[model samples]
Target: MYEGLMQKVMSDSKSKAGQYFTPRALIDSIIRLIQPQPGEIVQDPAAGTAGFLIAADRYIKDATDDLFTLSEDQGNFQRRQAFRGTNGCPTPTAFA
Candidate 1:
């Protein structure tokens, strides 16, 4: 849901939002370079809408082949605890 919304917003405002948003491919490439481990925390201090953090989450899930296995506590931890993004802007809905 959120990914679709973000994609739409990004497409609509590409000229303006390009600096604020990171492309999924680039984010994935960065995550692969960093190689976030299980249980490691990933953070983006200048996160616009947590594109990096979301990409890291996807990387971990894809690594484990458990993106849909939320019934497991490990999966829950990966989804909820593994990554965080803090924007300088006041409480963006993405962080909420």
Candidate 2:
């Protein structure tokens, strides 16, 4: 999923400008420094190809052992609520 988005971004000339792909080491370092906790909302306004989101998601899941296991609809609801009330962005929905 993320690869496809990256491909599309790379293909778009306008979007590609100033859009160097984030290296894995940099992402890993950021994740380690941030140390996102489970159920703690995160967002990146310039989430090019969702690299940060994907990394943060993986970090949170690994940290929490996948505790936030709500159904898709319920997850969406919680996500919306978090964003509306706290301006916190929810994790991406997991597709079945």
Indicate which candidate wins on TM-score.
Answer: 1
Worst 10 residues of 2 by lDDT: 87-96
What digit string (tens of lDDT, one per residue) describes model 1 on residues 1-96? 565576575665645534355667788899899998677888888777677887787777787875564447776777778777876654334764
Candidate 2 Cα errors over 4 Å, as ranges = 1-16, 68-96
- TM-score for model 1? 0.64
- Over 4 Å off in model 1, which ranges? 1-19, 67-73, 91-93
TM-score of each: 0.64, 0.55
lDDT of 2: 0.55
lDDT of each: 0.70, 0.55
Per-residue accuracy of model 2 over 1-96 as CA lDDT, tens digit each: 664555555555524354445666788799899987544667666564556767776776565455366566545543453221121223221210
The 10-residue segment of model 1 with minimum total lDDT is 12-21
